[model samples]
Target: MLHYAYGAVKKSMEAYVTRTGSNLLEVPLPFAVKSNDEIVSEFRKALERGKSNGNRVRLNVIDHVTSMPCVVIPVKELIQICREEWVDHVFVDAAHSIGCTDVDMKEIGADFYTSNLHKWFFYPPSIAS
Candidate 1:
């Protein structure tokens, strides 16, 4: 199950990089243990680096990490980060957040989103969409 979820994320990242010609793709730490301020600081750094290097930077944020309970990124901050010029794309991995939390994709404004229903909603192992 973990393999498939990661595979989907990998493919999506590849697609974004290919489409936008982005050389820098930033992914948050696993389990997302960092505080909101820390995450935003890192994202800003990545954007600054991308701007200086003349590359588009993409941010991949996991709404909720599977390994750590209560480790999540706030939607408001995510939206703010997405609005930055250096951020070409924002991908949200909501695999652990789909059914467990209230998520409105339209409000979040992510360029891409993926969730595994089977993990929480009990749909099917291969039915992630």
Candidate 2:
């Protein structure tokens, strides 16, 4: 499976990966990126790297919006690329997506998508959907 490099992922998701004992392949998102397309291109390279090693990328854990610097990731484009590359699963952590952006799950096409309502919708703490 693949995940965003440091400063781009939530701590809980990292901890969950550690607990599950899955090997993580980190894909860096340039802090000074010129465009969202740059990030998408990096993802494509990672997928290609995995394929070059004769392995299909099993999953891609995408952040709909990164937490650190609060950049909105191109989740829809990334998911579409994953589909084209035949990635088995795409899990979108949309923790900051709701209310902050227009989200349509059907169009996004991620296998798993989650958002914390409390993060934007003003729900009580720990409430998410």
Candidate 3:
């Protein structure tokens, strides 16, 4: 199984960019990040662009603080922000969270998770059951 999942979580972000031509990234630096902070900014920007905070998104998404690759974010804090912001989508990009970190879909409490096994879970190449 993929660690974080496929960039499924980003699917929501894509929607925002498609709907609104705005860029609000928490870590828009050398590389694009998938942190919880980034997720927050994306939603915040969407809301600022005439999007409904209560019903702006039909889904619920959140970013995570990963310690697997020197990445970290307070999941609880993000959740709190979600509740406070009233986001409609909650997707988490956990590509580096498969074997490197123990992730329980239920424990994470995210509406969606984007993880890849090949990245950290030692998944076999093109091996299928």
What TM-score against the true fold does each predicted structure earn? Answer: 0.66, 0.83, 0.49
| Candidate 1 per-residue C-alpha lDDT over 1-129 given as tens digits, one digit per residue, 9 for 90 to 100 | 111235556677678678977653454443534577765666566556666756444564445444344555665575566585646566677777787778888877877777888988789798776
Pairs clashing within candidate 1 = none
Candidate 2, residue 41: Cα displacement in angstroms equals: 1.1
Poorest 10 consecutive residues by lDDT, candidate 3: 23-32
Q: What would the per-residue lDDT of candidate 3 be over residues 25-106, giving only the tens digit for each residue?
A: 3322112456656645644554444343433434443435343334544454554555566655566666555665566677
Two-way lDDT contest, 1 vs 3, winner: 1
Candidate with more favorable, higher lDDT: 2 or 3: 2
Superior candidate under lDDT, 1 versus 2? 2
Ranking by TM-score: 2, 1, 3
